[model samples]
Target: MAEAGEGRYEIASVISRSFETVRSNLGLFAGLALILSGVPAFALNLWQTSFGVNLNAAQPDFSALLSAAYLGPLFVGWLVAMVTNAVLQASLTRATVTHLSGEKPVFAQCLTVGVSMILPMIGIGILLALGVGLAMLLLIVPGIILWLCWSVVVPVYVQEKVGVIEAFGRSMALTEGSRWRIFLTMLLVLVGLWLLSIPVGLLTVAVAATGSVIAVSLVTAIVSALGSMVMVTVQSCVYVELRNVKEGVAPADLEAIFA
Candidate 1:
């Protein structure tokens, strides 16, 4: 934990501290995940089950899936997911900041932080998504490069309270010499998440076999929420480590932002 706020972090220490954060504050992380991801995921899953449609299918049977009945719930679920994701990111950023500063994060206080930053956070997220999507449209490599380059934008925006444009610049600056490290960090996190999902995937399959939509939805939602929480924790840690190493930003400086 001490290493998390110090001079430099190897990839291993960053990951270790992230897990420690989650372990030490399981209730806070779980509650945030439930509010931000579990409910929306469950709602979406339930809606899809009720509609008897898979909006996520590679080759969806549009004849039935394109109807008003299907589109209505689909749109609602999408909106819910989008809004909740924005909230989750903001909440996680705030909570992680507070935790790293060695303070107990109050749920309401964290929520307030999230609410305050939701607009700018969501705006930047949308812009980044559009930028990545456009790059992907042009070429796959460019999209991946852009994603890596802008990886720390969210944490920068939250911690620095910069505008979206400045946040992008700040992220690029912090990630300058460490883009490869960030890539490896992302890769490791993804691999870990995939491994974590295996058990949940099996559970989903088993539940699906029973033809109980609610059960399947509930299990899937829980798994998705857990994954989201872990990823956010790791991401926040990565941002802090990067700032510490790149700009010599002390932990006290970080805490002072909130103070």
Candidate 2:
């Protein structure tokens, strides 16, 4: 296998290493996915499709749609899920970095690192969202371009410990000559996930037909969490490779950040 620090990496290696990392950390990652993503997804879906209905009516009560009681818990859950996902991302970044550096990762320590970094992550996310949203509004091509450029921002932020704004610049710097490669990798990952979801989609339909919203929601959440894990694993690998190429920073250096 080619070393990652050679300023070159095969897509196959990144994918293989990612799977290996996730498999090795499956227990912790699974718990993170379930609590941080799956539970919230299940809860929100169940509330909306099951407990949310007016018991006195055959259909949803249109008048009550805008009521505080209807939206409050759901919104709260959504916010919580958002925060939980950010923390999960940070935790995964830390886990991957440490593991690659030959250290055993602790879930609690990752969680703590995640919690500390949550606010900055949120700030960068909002900035990126607005940038992408505005570019998308203009024509859509620019948005895609921007998306590719910023694809590794979270990993950049988490790994570098730079300021939120600096992370954007750092990502752009690292991705300068490699945007096409990054875009193609992202495209492949998305297409692969979409293909995998076909069977999952059919299963969801079957579950929905059974008239059990909980079952359908559970399946959806699990699939979504799985997707999240795959995406983050790829991202963390990419970030490591990028740093190795651009700065000659080895995995051992990254491990020392947490040491």
Cα RMSD (angstroms) for every candidate in the order listed? 3.8, 4.0
Per-residue C-alpha lDDT of model 1 across residues 1-259, encoded as one tens digit per residue: 2234334547987788788888888999899999889999998888788876566889877788778888887888887788788888888877887788788878888888787887787788799999999999999989988887888888888888788999998887777767777778879999988987887788889999999999998998988898889888888888888877866875547888645
Clashing pairs in 2: none
The candidate 1 region of ten consecutive residues with least summed lDDT is 1-10
All models: lDDT? 0.83, 0.81
Q: How do the residues 175-240 of candidate 2 rate in per-residue lDDT, one tens digit apiece?
A: 766677777777788899999999999999998899887798799889988889789878888788
Superpose all Cα atoms of candidate 1 onto the true structure and report the RMSD in Å to 1 decimal: 3.8
Candidate 1 segments whose C-alpha is farther than 4 A from its true place: 1-9, 54-61
Name the lDDT value of residue 251 in candidate 2.
73
Cand. 1 TM to true fold: 0.91
Q: Kindly give the number of clashing pairs for every candidate.
A: 0, 0
The pairs that clash in candidate 1 are: none
Among these predicted structures, which one has the highest lDDT?
Answer: 1
TM-score of 2: 0.88
